[model samples]
Target: MKSEQGDPIPLWERSEPAVRPAPSPLSRDNIVRSAIALADSEGLSAVSLRKVASSLDAGAMRLYRYLSTKDELLDLMADAVYGEIVSEGPIVGEWRDTLRTIANRIRSACREHPWFIELLGGRPHMGPNALAMLEASFAALNDSPGFDTVDASMQAIRTVNAYVIGAVQAENSDLKNSMSKADWQKVWWPYLERLIATGNFPMLAKIIRDASHPSPDIIFDTGLETVLDGLGSQISR
Candidate 1:
């Protein structure tokens, strides 16, 4: 098969080996699962072909038969997680509701696997599960009044995806450095108060004084609704 930029065709696009596996209990799924588990427990940096093989009680060379390089293995691992998003079934109800469901589900998955944000946009995700997600999303927008053409529909999907990725990244950042509300007041608020007291940034001071400190969940939902509102306007027009 032809290579792209000197790299072999992605694992998803490559044809499977013609020969069947010899008598062995190991499979590609097993290897991917083991790798995912390792990442979940010890972070993404901990995952290696040798470590995955060790978890499966198999030799590292056996894994090379399925995945030739660490990059290929990482692609497979990403696709495996995308499978979870696909299992949620197709989008339902109005276009807005469909997008909301998708965004929320992706957020949940990212939270569950903190390493997911690091892997986002790292490679093309053309595996079966990832393709299934794209197909389902396109189907949802196929009848939307605002999206009369394939390109328009895809653009709408892209808009929502961009928002979801950014929102999740922000939320994940807070989660990584999370502290209890009381703890934050004691430890960080003093420094923040000192900064606010300086007359240099009045608008920032007003916001801190006037705005309620909403939880991350509230912030995510509010931003998502605003995005849908903008999309709804186009649909209505």
Candidate 2:
């Protein structure tokens, strides 16, 4: 297969016209999409070339037409999920607001897809869209009125990216399922209260006493606001 640069690296391994004697029958796009759907439904670990081929009603060897290996297909799938994110540029017209928009977009995309979380942690993105997304974000901060240099832009963008990724991690723990508020309290609170009542962990006890609920939404928004506030000073300076 050739890269976007037209450099021929390798081709399919199988033989025969029915298998991969000619060229790829499944386009890279089709392979990526199928992989994503399988991963989304059955989890990333459930994804295999054989599984995808079965889903497409094609021979297992047919996938070699497009992807050189399962690794290539996995990389393409990661990029495919990233491509779903739609950035708004900037809504509030401030550098911090622009950061927020980028953060929200990243969070929305990653958090919504369980497979993406696992994929990104290991794969280095070579996809055009993924590269474009990163470069575009850097440009937004660099071109903003307050942003002056690479250091400033990097710092601000890093903070925004960190919070977004943190939120995605938070979402993943709840990925399998979620419990209702009453159920959560009924199960977890009693244990927490018992620990707090013991006065063993002072900081823990203080926090538990002051906070009435374990709200993931509140944690995300509060962290988001604080991150924005910190970056605002750095950007404005």
Candidate 3:
């Protein structure tokens, strides 16, 4: 299959250089690992072949031998993070419990590597690690009694995955705001109080006055349970 670069073979499908100079430390794994580390520190936009090569103390062009394009590098980086998700041991339990484990692992990986969802753009991942992850989720759902058909199982998996992607994206977006919670309350709380005093937003005013601000983890867990509950109702039919 073609990569985004239009290569006849995707980077993951290509064999590593069979004739690299002896004792050379440059390999596809090293290049991708270096790239991931760079992205982890500097953000995804900061990663490039030149920077990755320099990080590895290798020539910039040397990286081309491993991956011909930046998109390919991105594929490797994303899959590496997927490998982290897989590293969490086998997911075992009832269908709901199994899905909860899978969803939580995915959320943790994205939180650790914030650039992961960004890399998910419009391209489908074909990497082995990504495939394995999908396989595990599908298998879990397919084994469940109510998910009797492949289409039913696939729909359930997609719903859970979409919830995770959207939820993590919201969390990451909130994190982008640099203001500390104390600063936010000290500065904006007064202004928000004035807005609430207007009595135009009764529900919002009530929330501001009464709702306990839950932690992100609590919000995520609550939302996941709701999603699973909805799915459970659908499947029980």
- What TM-score fits each model? 0.86, 0.78, 0.91
Per residue, candidate 1 scores C-alpha lDDT tens digits across 73-179 of 88788888889988877788778888898888888888878777778755657788888888988898788667788997777788888898898888878877889
TM-score of 1: 0.86
> For residue 166, what is the lDDT in candidate 2?
65
Off by over 4 Å in 3: 1-7, 19-24
**Best by TM-score, which number?**
3
Report lDDT (CA) for all predictions.
0.82, 0.71, 0.84
Candidate 3, after superposition: displacement of residue 66 in Å? 0.9
TM-score of 3: 0.91
Cα lDDT of model 3 by residue, 1-237, tens digit: 466787698567787876566435788888888988998888899999999988988789877878888888999899899898888878777888987998899898888888886975358888999999888887776677887899987787778888888898899899887688799899898988888889887998888779998999999999999999999999887
Candidate with the greatest lDDT versus the true structure: 3
- lDDT by residue for model 2 over 125-168, one digit each (tens)? 76766776778777777667767778877777767776677677
Better of 1 and 2 by TM-score: 1
Q: Model 3, residue 89: displacement in angstroms?
A: 1.9
